[model samples]
Target: AVAFCESVQPLEAVVSLMAQRLALAEDVARYKWNQKVEIEDSAREQMIITKLKAQAVAEGLPEAWSETFFKAQIAASKATQKQLFAEWQQHHAAAFEGVPDLNSQTRPKLYALMSELITALHQAWQPLQQPECQPVVDKLVREKLAKPGYKVAGEPLFAVH
Candidate 1:
């Protein structure tokens, strides 16, 4: 089952990145709200997806698989942002102070996470095809609940089967 564990390792990285991205979304929502910018940036999202597709091709990963994984991450981030904004609106919250620049600060960090995720995917891609992959991933996620603030959003991409 070493291969199973190896396959699931990348998924753990993906989950870690997802949690971090969700946390970052709070700051992003604050900045957007204060700046009168919309939370949903379709152009930016598409640009990132396009970049991911190209990177996937370069890395020998299936473009469709990588795109689907990245799309899930984007969806989760947007959902968190929307929820935070709605909560702020309900409370009539004041503008956040010392908000960071989205393009310069936030996006760079997200890009780094994306790079790490891609590397992990490249490492785990073949092992993910093993029959034991899904069960091992599920177990790891369950084990992760012992850590505070650890969460699994939806299912791991390789766990679909």
Candidate 2:
């Protein structure tokens, strides 16, 4: 959905996808919690980042830059999940109802969105490297990923070298 969404700028589309990905953390956390799964999955995270870095190379984008951006998204997602877990714990909440399976459903969706995000980011790569893009990217990030735990490092993420 994020990938096909019409936008004036590819960079804006990037932010939208990032926001969409972050938003999915809720369902992910719920499913994980309901299934008694751990919040941190370092192995899977590394695998994903590594895979994306390789893809970034193929796309003519800087690997570290791409990793940084995705890492920020992961961090924000984890933060939101952790916060949700804490709240659920304090409230002694029951398992979430109607959450999608992480493997069969959620992950496939996330991968699709990630693919689109990569394409959008590649399209916006040149402009994103400009110094002037920092403020604009930061502003968009703030507006799109506005939730408290969803906030990322903002302007600092645009420096791709």
Per-model TM-score versus the true fold: 0.80, 0.87
User: Pick by lDDT: which candidate is best?
Assistant: 2
Give the Cα-based TM-score of candidate 2 against the true structure: 0.87
**How many clashes does the backbone of model 2 have?**
0
Across 1-161, the per-residue lDDT of candidate 1 in tens digits comes to 25334456676765566566656767787889899889888998899999988987898888777777777777767777777787888999999899898889988988887877778767666556666666665565455422222232434455532
TM-score of candidate 1 relative to the true fold: 0.80
* Candidate 1 colliding pairs: none
Q: What is the C-alpha RMSD of each candidate to the true structure, in Å?
A: 3.8, 5.6
Write candidate 2's Cα lDDT for 1-161 as tens digits.
Answer: 22322333877888888788878889999999999999999999999889887887888777777788778777888888898999999999999889998999888877777778888888877667666666677778878884754456343355665
> Any runs in candidate 2 off by more than 4 Å, and if so which?
1-8, 153-156
The 0-to-1 C-alpha lDDT of every candidate, in the order given, reads 0.70, 0.78
